[model samples]
Target: MLGRLFLKLEFKKVDYAELYLWLGSLMKNNCKQRRQFLVMAAGLLAASVVPAWAAGVSGEVKALEGVAWRNDQPLKLGDPIMLGDHLRTGADSKLVVRLGGDVYLLRANGSLQLENKGLVLGSLRLLSGALLAVFAKSNKQIITPTVTAGIRGTGLYVEASEQSTYFCLCYGEVELMPMHQRSQQFRFKANHHKAHTLDAKGGVEKSPLRNHNDDELAILEALAGRKPHALVG
Candidate 1:
């Protein structure tokens, strides 16, 4: 079993630090659990490796539950996620993907479109759904019907609809611009979660953090072979 797992993991590569972290977390487990951890680590290691790409494929699905579609075709774990693809999740579904060093989680009943400039994700258009993501330090944007957010190396969560959008800058910095009122745009930095809502009329309002947490950010960062701020120490 361990050999098979290793062979499977050979498809990708992970950082040694990630391996050590995983080991530390599971060191207290029983023998069988330890084996299970090895298997899971093998998979994670595979995901961290940059595979030889097919044209336009810049990433792959790391975790998937229930049903998902990529460009209207059935999506599966380990499948390459290409640039400019449309991704959707069915009821009760969840999808996690890694691109470069970034990680994203899409919740049930969500639709998102990837916009890439070269190999980097330039923007994410949340057509209608909920998404949580952690990005490596870079300039990027998140777009919704009601708002567009310019972000720099941040962990973020958003839920979008035609009438309103909920946004949480989980960490780092953001410049938020409401669709109907770019004149009212504002910028802020967040050491922790900071929440807001944008309405169709180009209004921005303070909102309470909801539907996301630091633990989820940690999970996403781990999948990308990095640590969240809270776990850095």
Candidate 2:
């Protein structure tokens, strides 16, 4: 019974998660412009619950280079990220967002949605290009075009495109499951192990870890209030 319940809960309609994220921030309170905010965020109450979270504060804007856009606005260095923020980076651009228990590196030509339930990260959807991250022990989900992985205290990298997605769990554990086919789930635990495709049925075989490095993990870990297991003297 317990096993069945777990499996049932694992199957989430992640495609609609983005839609909810886009409209999730409508629920807020104690605003100076309460009437105006409510007008824009009217129907968001059903999507998001009330919580006491720091407004417009998702993470510390550590560094950025080249040009980037946040929700279509020019992304500044010290801008605090709000929930449902759509982040996009252009050529030669780079961005680092340090969140609670996690840090994200968004490489050039990438886009993603920051989705959280009341300041707790629920789903982080990497739309395109490269995204590198190290997560602390927390309930977070990583989503790409073809793959969705449940992450907890994990180090991972993803490069997503319309054709396919490149995924590698650098350290710790991740549950590799397909968005279309949730039955063929694979749980992986290791350092520098790669799972390129979505599933075994006509899916590409696992490849050796490539691209990402341990030092990168160490850097993100430092910002996330932890030390990377790979870092050694």
Candidate 3:
């Protein structure tokens, strides 16, 4: 009877040991599952925060020769950018821009200021020199020294000089408005050119001009230190 009691006690101890081991294993598995769940939750939270941080214009900016300044510093290609900003290109430096399916080839010796107020399409103020603007579906405007070209979905070329400003439409129509006198406006058709001659009183000559190769010729003349031939003489 004594031997049987001792054996029964040993068996009870063995069962308790097994139960304790099983409990330990279950606790370890639970802890691992909880850790995995926490990791997955953190990954999802990071993914949700990315798109809200990227609502502005971002693109590559390349300078051919001189420096290109953004926010008063030099700009680099493939760097992220925003609007309502001023950029100054170094002397004899060209700027190449790519943003939202639009490409702008900016000639050397120029400055551009962008104004994007969300509702209104962005506006560009060209301080000087020439720029070839190619637009997508959106309308683009170029505010020159003496004229403003309201471009409708097309490619256009603009050149500025001390005496006047020139606009040559290659693909679409551009409404030219003299800034000095807001009432005087003209529509320049595709394959047509117009010149806004500046006078003492900020007045412009309203004349229809002709220049077939003015777009190509302006680039050449700008490089050669000569004023391009005026189409609307």
Candidate 4:
């Protein structure tokens, strides 16, 4: 009954460390059999709760490298990156942010402006530099100066500049369309990596994956409480 009750809890919102400490205090007052039951319940609770909690948390700074900024202020670990925030990274810096079931890694010299629907981010604009992202099944889009990508539960890497956008569908599917000619659109499905270059004149050219890799995708996905679908079995 105790294990069942714990399983029914919305544990994502609970502080697990404090919960464990409280359980420890209670166990000290119980007999051996009750203590054993509590230990068992704790194990079950942890296994069920962690993934849910990680997937449900939004606006969390999961990792930061070198120096980064959020809304023009110096960024720190564990900072809450709210929806509609303006984010930037310094030269040689990187930033990782978790938004509900998705994770994004912004590369050096990147500038991003987030767009939100209520409290959740539905889309984002990469003003300059590069970004790598993974998403859970949702209606999400990424916009750049030269192109826009509508993604559905996919892994993507993009670099944006004034003239062109380098886009790589790391895995899964994406609909890529040029900003200048929205009528020129194409869907790409990749099991590994499929690369393209979108020019300002609305030309799509096939390219090679240059800077990102599977290992980096795995790392970001793990932080979002999942594994790359290719690595899962």
- Backbone clash count for every predicted candidate, in the order shown: 1, 0, 1, 0
Worst 10 residues of 3 by lDDT: 44-53
Question: Which ranges of candidate 3 are over 4 A from the true structure?
Answer: 1-57, 119-121, 161-163, 192-233
After superposing candidate 1 on the true structure, give the runs of residues whose Cα lies further than 4 Å from its correct spot. Answer: 1-57
Q: What is the C-alpha lDDT of each candidate?
A: 0.78, 0.65, 0.53, 0.76
Clashing pairs for model 4 are: none
lDDT of 1 by residue, 1-233 (tens): 44554454556444333343344455555667665554455346435655324334588887777899999999976788878999999999888888776788999999999998886679999999999999888899999999999987889999999999999988899999999898888897898888988899987789999987665676676566664454554
> What tens digits encode model 4's per-residue C-alpha lDDT throughout 77-161?
7788878999999998878887777889898999999999776787889999999998989888999999989999999999999
Give the Cα error of residue 73 in candidate 3, in Å: 0.6
What residue pairs clash in candidate 3, if any at all? 66-93
Sort the candidates on TM-score, descending order: 1, 4, 2, 3
TM-score per candidate, chains pooled: 0.78, 0.71, 0.58, 0.76
Report how far off residue 50 is in candidate 4 (Å).
4.7
In candidate 3, what are the lDDT values of residues 1-233, reduced to their tens digit?
32442353334422222222232344445655433323332333223222211436454452234567777878765455566667667776666654554556667777777777584447778877777665655677888777777876565666666557766666557787777777877776654444445442356555444332333333222222223222223
Worst 10 residues of 1 by lDDT: 15-24
Report the lDDT of model 3 for residue 90: 75
* C-alpha positional error of residue 134 in candidate 2 after TM-score superposition, expressed in Å: 0.7
